[model samples]
Target chain A: MNANDPILETLNLVKEFKGFVAVNGVSLKLKRGSIHALIGPNGAGKTTVFNLLTKFLAPSSGMIFFNGVDITGERPAQTARRGIVRSFQISAVFPHMSVLENVRVALQRRLGNSYRFWQPENSLLQLNEHAMALLADVGLETFADTLTVELPYGRKRALELATTLATEPELMLLDEPTQGMGHEDVHRVTEMIRKAAVNRTILMVEHNMSVVSSIADTITVMQRGSVIAEGSYAEVSANPQVIEAYMGTTDTALQGAH
Target chain B: MRLTTYVYIALAALAVLAPLIGLYPVFVMKLLCFAIFACAFNLLLGYTGLLSFGHAAYFGAAAYTTGYLVKTLHWTPEVAILGGMALAAFSGLIVGAMAIRRQGIYFAMITLALAQMLYFVCLQLKLTGGEDGLQGVPRGNLFGMLSLSNDTTMYYFVLALFVTVFLLIRRIVHSPFGQILKAIRENEPRAVSLGYDVERYKLLAFVLSTTLAGLAGSLKTLVFGFATLSDVHWSMSGEVILMTLLGGVGTFFGPVLGAGIVVALQDNLADKVGSWVSVIIGAIFVVCVMAFRRGLVGEAQAFFGRKKKTA
Candidate 1:
């Protein structure tokens, strides 16, 4: 494919639950290696779009193309296998598993032994070094043996990122990865995301304007189930319509967000 | 060695010496059989977090199949047990495929529905002996030479399988496969997003659990010389859940201890209280749930851990 071609594309995607349209006539192109951010106000159908792209929710009509391959109608797991990995807005980790074991759960799938119950688990220690490396990347090496449920909320988010990283995806879809995290965690995670974005494409639904401005290479602003603007942070942030979408035509500029 | 290792050896010693010390061999065998049932059920409900209310279908299917094969075709005990496992696996596949489509309470409902169908078939089908149940299952020689006819001999035979399964379960729980099951149990949607075909993992867990439960049923048939309606009833399924919960739902030794207590209560109180046995069991279940939600072994471990901390 051409370098100019989008690495991922959705043509006129529409999702309706019952009679309400959640995502309507949305079309977009994600450039190769770009840190694309999908930002919108509450109820703007951002999460619904993520769900549709990952095949968690079947679209009422439209298509999803990944790396120029038609990947619509694939199973949710099939979507994941096609190198599109998404993280939940809620922190997701196996609670009872040790922090190390949580990351190993993701890494072990690549070892091609997902169904070998007869073998001793000691065999899985071979993955310990790799699992520990991922945890170390997230600064979680010290808490390796701690149960995930007992970790503080912010650390759980970091562990969630670590587990997501263990999947080694080509395209990472992060849904509000820093939604409830404190300021310090948000900056740490933002830096971690920038570090993690080295060789892969990241499409994130982020609300933090400062995060969007700092790291997002391209911003797609949605207003009530449609993309109102798409451009660099400077272009989208400066647009009056984008400003109206957020602050509702108030005298205060969109600058109020930061 | 660790303290747990010493505890295991001591427990093994007790099991080996039980019949000699006047604990009835048949009673011990019966409890062990139920222990296996509870353990198998725990693998699904406790580990996988899939509550299957219809597990009796697989257990009873194996018991009935073994009863038929041994009583009529005169199959060897080893072959007969394998036959029972195969039937259980097959039945488990059918039940699991349909049941796993719905989750949580709905999943439990569907399994219960399918199992009730199996129970009716057992009650109506002539092959299952209708109401009289599949009776006269033989305790034939284990390998065509070593007899299981004597209660002590059969006890060891059953004991060997029990110990193997206990360790096997611990291994499985620690295995990579078990980790996937735990991931699913902890967060199913997240597991799906991780590219796991969650339905397949759940189905496999269901099949493995049913087959183990089937092995226990087959042994019970051979032990008691019968596969009766009680084994096939919905109450049997509920009883297994009770055993798991009473002993501790997710703990490794919880099911074993729960099965022991439950089976002991039934054996001792059946003559004294008649049908009041169920009422007593129900009371115990409520008391256990309210008083010790962690289960006997789980609470013991927590208590022990506390004592260790103080010391």
Candidate 2:
């Protein structure tokens, strides 16, 4: 219950899929109210760490602690209920629902009325103003009534963020929040993430270095299922081992392309 | 108000006026019963995107129960129907718990297999009357007062039940709970991450669908004066799916339209074409799948939806 205790901590987490190790003995910590980034090259198992932390995948060995509670054996929904909500690498929205309704579904979960099937939906009209406010926060208020599937890819990502924000997570885990975005959307989302990071802890798996350097309070660099470096952006960027891992992967990828 | 709302009001008016217009009361009652059955089936297949190939279990089980109660116990019609519905809901809960552990085609196959088991149990049970089935089921008085012996009285009763169940389904589809079910259908992982107990929601939806299907079966037994092997057969489950798909799987009135067409087709062709009815129905299903794909109501909605956008 100490104020300065790490909001989330992992102790020697290991995940193996058959003969292959996806996350090997990875221990990490995030201080309260800080934005932490997990970055690595292709096949570096960055996504595996996020999955293990969110309990989407169980660890072969080790434990995860969130707010001084052990949650390694918890299910995905249980972890989310404990305030560790996540967004998918692929844009995940209720495609047929309107953008406003998408956020309202999340809000309805918070209100604990999702099981009230017998009641008229108009009784939920009171939630409209709050749902619209969340949409407005993500700049989706203009397209509030648009079906989520019809939205442009960038806007769908924004709507996804809006829905995730509706849950009011204590530790938000965003997997590739700005993946496949153009330059303009990348900047917009980075700023949005920075704004959202205030007064909450964030642990994100991002490939864009600019987004990582701009918003991340601490960076954990992984290579081949283990942490290679951990520090501030400047310190991690300058680390020889980190640079070598990136350069080595780029050369290997270029050679494979030939 | 939406155009669909106006259409629903007009349809309800026609239903009320049908018996007065010299239409066959018994035939219309049969159509109404099947329409309710199709709507209940659509709730799972169309809206929730769970294709249950075993809905006949609930529908037939309820029919048998209602038939037994009315014939043997001399229970009132209303009490018998409620009893059947409750039994169906309980059965739905047990079956749903096991079936929902799998997804996609596996789920469909499991439901089909379970329903086949139920069919065998019905065939062996003395209460179900085996092959000859439960016959001469009395359509008792409404609340032990008004006589349901008159065809017109029975037609109106069936119409009332149909409208009530239809409105209940409409209310549920637009409710907050329905929104969560749709979310789960669209992306289960995302719904799970949103802290919704997805399996529980799915189970509740299954129970709701089966209970309504049971209501329809009970009404059908009262209308036809029998609960036969045809009611519980796997082909009945397939017929409900056909109704939903042919009418438009996800559209509100699609199943009703599908059921009307199917029932009317069967009634007209059964005497004239002998066993060719199955062949003709199969042909129509193939054409619908290939050309329309969205079923009758769905295609009509899209057609008018485009017209509105252009206008």
Which structure among the candidates has the greatest DockQ? 1
Would you list the clashing residue pairs of candidate 1?
none
Model 2 pairs whose backbones collide: none
The runs of at least 3 residues in candidate 2 whose Cα sits more than 4 Å from the true structure, single-residue gaps closed, are A249-258, B1-6
Q: Which stretches of candidate 1 lie over 4 Å from their true place?
A: A256-258, B1-3, B309-311
lDDT of 2 by residue, A69-138 (tens): 9999998899999999999999989998899888988888877778878888887788899999998888
For model 2, residues B26-53, the per-residue Cα lDDT tens digits are: 9999999999999999988887889999
User: CAPRI band of model 2?
Assistant: medium
Local accuracy of candidate 1 as per-residue lDDT tens digits, B1-311: 26777888898999999989999999999999999999999999899889999888888999999999999999999899999999999999988988887879999999999889999999999988999998778899888999999999999999999998888888888888988988898998889888999999989989999999999999999999999888889999999999999999888889999999999999999999999999999999999999999888888888888988899
